[model samples]
Target: MVLANIQQGEKESLRSYTNRFFAAAAEMEDVNPTVAIPNYRRGLISGDLSKSLQLVKPKSFPELMARASQFMLLEDTGNGAPDV
Candidate 1:
C-alpha cells in the first residue's frame, strides 16, 4: 500500500508528519488499523513518540492518534523527549 511507504521527512516535525500521514490515510477507503498503525509507527522518526508507540502498542487508530497528539504537544512546547 502507498501508505505503508509514507515516511516522516528527515527534518519534519512530528505534528507536520502526523498531518501528512492523516491526509494520506483519509484518501484511502476502509483503512485497517492493523496495517495503518504499523505503518504509522514505522514512519515516525526516532524520538519519544516513536519509542512510546513501540513499547506500548495502541489497540486502535484513535488510541494511536491520542498518543501522537500528546507527544506532538510536548514537542511543540520544547519537551520533545518525554520522561518515558
Candidate 2:
C-alpha cells in the first residue's frame, strides 16, 4: 500500500489537518508510536495547536490522539485558538 504524503493545507483547520495526518499514519504497516508521535507533531501547522501538543509531550500515538481530541474540543468551545 502506498502512503500519501500528508501536509497541512493553507486555511485548513487544525482538526482537519490532524485527521488527515492520523489517517495516513494509520495505514503504515509497522510504524513505531514513539517515532510517529513526533512526526505527527511536526506535521502540524505552527501555532497554538502545535505548541500545545508539544507542551503535553505525548509519548505514544494514543497519547497524541487523546491530546488532539482535547484540543479539538477546546477549539470547538472557542477556547483554544489564539486571537489574531
Best-matching candidate per lDDT: 1
Worst 10 residues of 2 by lDDT: 1-10
Could you give me the TM-score of model 2 versus the true structure?
0.76
Q: Which stretches of candidate 2 lie over 4 Å from their true place?
A: 1-5, 81-84
Across 1-84, the per-residue lDDT of candidate 1 in tens digits comes to: 488898999999899999989889999999998989999999988878888989999989889988998998888898656665
The global Cα lDDT (0 to 1) of model 2 is: 0.72
| Residue-by-residue lDDT tens digits, candidate 2, 1-84 | 222356677777768978788777777879877767777777677877688766768887777777788777777787855431
| Error at 41, model 2, angstroms | 1.2
Residue 72 shift from truth in candidate 2, angstroms: 0.7
Q: Cα RMSD (Å) between model 1 and the true structure?
A: 1.5
The global C-alpha lDDT for each of the candidates, from Candidate 1 onward, is 0.88, 0.72
